[model samples]
Target: MQSLGLDVLFKGTNFLRLLEGLWVSVRISLISVVISILLGLVAGVLMTSKNIVLKAAFRVYLEIVRIMPQMVLLFIVYFGTTRVFGWNLDAEASAVIVFVFWGVAEMGDLVRGALISIPKIQYESAEALGLTKQQTYLYVILPQTVRRLIPLSINLVTRMIKTTSLVLMIGIVEVLKVGQQIIEANRRTSPNAAFGVFAVVFLLYFLICWPVSRLAGYLEKRWAA
Candidate 1:
């Protein structure tokens, strides 16, 4: 059997470079997720409010995000901003902005659904107990909403991590970008370089995401019980 010479991955600092790139992806996803969750929580709670204008504004934001393809959003932020506004945004910053926009919309909708899923009786019961609106949310409604939101939110986290691959189009040197570089460098000498590098990228993503998915399932089952 002809050896595929997968050793190229381990050659010199190749593996370390991949790790550094993976760190960039992870860092962007993590920070964006944090910001998304906070913003989503607020937008979601506001979505359930009785005020038509407030709800209508957030509804439009949600619709825009849902309708726009993330890649298009990335381009608009990274390239369009530079052309139109001369903003001089870096690739990583543009990636963060796009992902945070996507994440906030998705997470907000998830939160809205979770909050609305609670029966009206729950709210009435809180009122019957003479709980203030804030107290009701703090002590009763939010806890249940959180349990419902957790599993879905974790899934979003995985989605954001995977989607960070799109950042490469704007020249962020994340894992996929690193893999491309490795494959290009070895294109002549190692015919199997693309296969080997992409396989490693697949495994790295699975290694990062699979645990989060499993935890979501466990929590779902536990909450259901």
Candidate 2:
């Protein structure tokens, strides 16, 4: 029995390999997202801090992260850091580190934007109602900020998933890397395998990212509505 392309996609071992690769991607993305959100929130708040030192520090951090390309960051962490420090770092670990660093900076900027976008009158009204600093943040400011933050954070998640592809450069056997290996292994038997395998890789990424994109859009609309 000849195997069709769909058969390759669904056969037991192939399915397991694909799932394993996907699980690695998901694990990295999920952990990176959590770290990014927590640290980003803190940095974001600091970016808006009244203290000049805090704000300036956060601004510098944001600028550096935003300007540094992810591939260069990965290389620095995985190669330069290890060579300079005499430390060993695996590709997966380095990928997660790079993504979290980038994601945190991006999320912090998004959060800073949201926080600043809040009207000053809202703060005044909170104070007029006898709300203390903590109380205002807890009751008045955070609720509104959360509504604005969710969709933006979803957008960040989508970006992180896509950037995981760059992990291949650092030798992580992610889906794209695995696909490349499969195509290379079959190059002699299937000369056109490169295009076919890469198409599958593209579709896999689209499937992963599209739903998150839709979710972000839906939240924005429902909130706006």
Candidate 3:
């Protein structure tokens, strides 16, 4: 019997393929998070407005996003759109769309909460100082809001990175999918291949997420101090 080793990862271009898959996951997550942040900021600010129609519209959107499961949303974008609209959207694109929708809803709520948490007196004081709305937000409110936002947003980025694994369901050859492929290819020769491959995948995820988590914690402490 051949000795069990992690030779499978190093064989031919297997390891390179895994790295490529990991890069795909990272790329999708980064793009989705950036888009989500922009959309969330707009939605959150709109949500706080006094316009009843605007608030109601965004409220419905928030409720729909919160109520639906992400996997369901993924299927809807990936499968449902293709069947219903005859759109040939690729798996990675669908994954990004679903994640962006989810991220926007979550980040919007965070922004809204941060915005609302500011004491009413702060707004009054800014007005008293003859600060225009734009100046007030730019100089006073937004800075404070961003301090409260950074830690939470960083946590969301980690979530986005981890959640990219779900894209495998729709056939994106992400890291997790590549790991599974490696395990299958060596299933007969190396019985322990699955364990090693998955272990590496776990480590990769941990390595990517751990520092972001630590940064979030550090920022929280620094902000509080």
Candidate 4:
């Protein structure tokens, strides 16, 4: 124990601070995920429209999200925007904004794929049965879309949670940042503090994400049947 420097976690509220930092990450992720779901639904519907201009715009947005790294997006939103526009956005807010922007694009693509996967024959069958547009959606199309969507969207939540680690670059003081601070503070007395602190951080992240991933898997199987 002494050799590993795990004891440093017991020092003067250090562990508590780590938990607090983790909560900040979780809070940001939850808020962003909620906003992403709402907006992604709208963006997804727009993506399926027959209008060429609208499809082109969404395609461009999706391409930008895919090509640009999330870390770069964070820097642009948190650092560049303030320097360029003289805006005073807080760090947490900036993290949330960057994540939502990314999340919406990804989620929108998922939605588009789910919507398009339903065969045209299904729509034709619904029309033959005298189902109106809304009725067709509510009864036939939406039910299947939701089954495919829920598991994928739940997985996206875990992705967002893990990605929150990047927010530390923008000075959010989330879990990874807290671990760094602890290791730095204990460098002299606990030279191996980095190993123990980081190990714990990894455990915390696993504890949070494993169950979510499992739930997504279970839902995917359950719904597919």
Task: Encode model 3's per-residue lDDT on 12-121: one tens digit a residue.
Answer: 89889988989999999999999999998877777789999988888888898989988889999999998999999988889999999999988998999999988999
lDDT of 4 by residue, 1-225 (tens): 888778999999999999998999899999999999889988987899999999999999999999999999999998899899999889899999999999999889888899999999999999999999989988998788878999999989999999999998888899999999999999999999999999999999988899989999999888887
Clashes of 4: 0
List the pairs of residues colliding in candidate 2. Answer: none
Sort all candidates by TM-score, best to worst.
Answer: 1, 4, 3, 2
lDDT for model 2 comes to 0.82
Model 3 per-residue lDDT at 151 = 94
Q: What Cα-based lDDT does every candidate model obtain? A: 0.90, 0.82, 0.89, 0.92
Error of 4 at 40 (Å): 1.1
lDDT of candidate model 3 versus the reference = 0.89
Candidate 3, superposed: residue stretches over 4 Å from native: 1-5
lDDT of 1: 0.90
Per-residue lDDT of model 2, residues 16-123, tens digit only: 676577767777898999999988887787788899888788778888897999999999999998899978998888888999889888888888899999999999
Candidate with maximal lDDT: 4
- What are the TM-scores, per candidate, against the unseen true structure? 0.95, 0.91, 0.94, 0.95
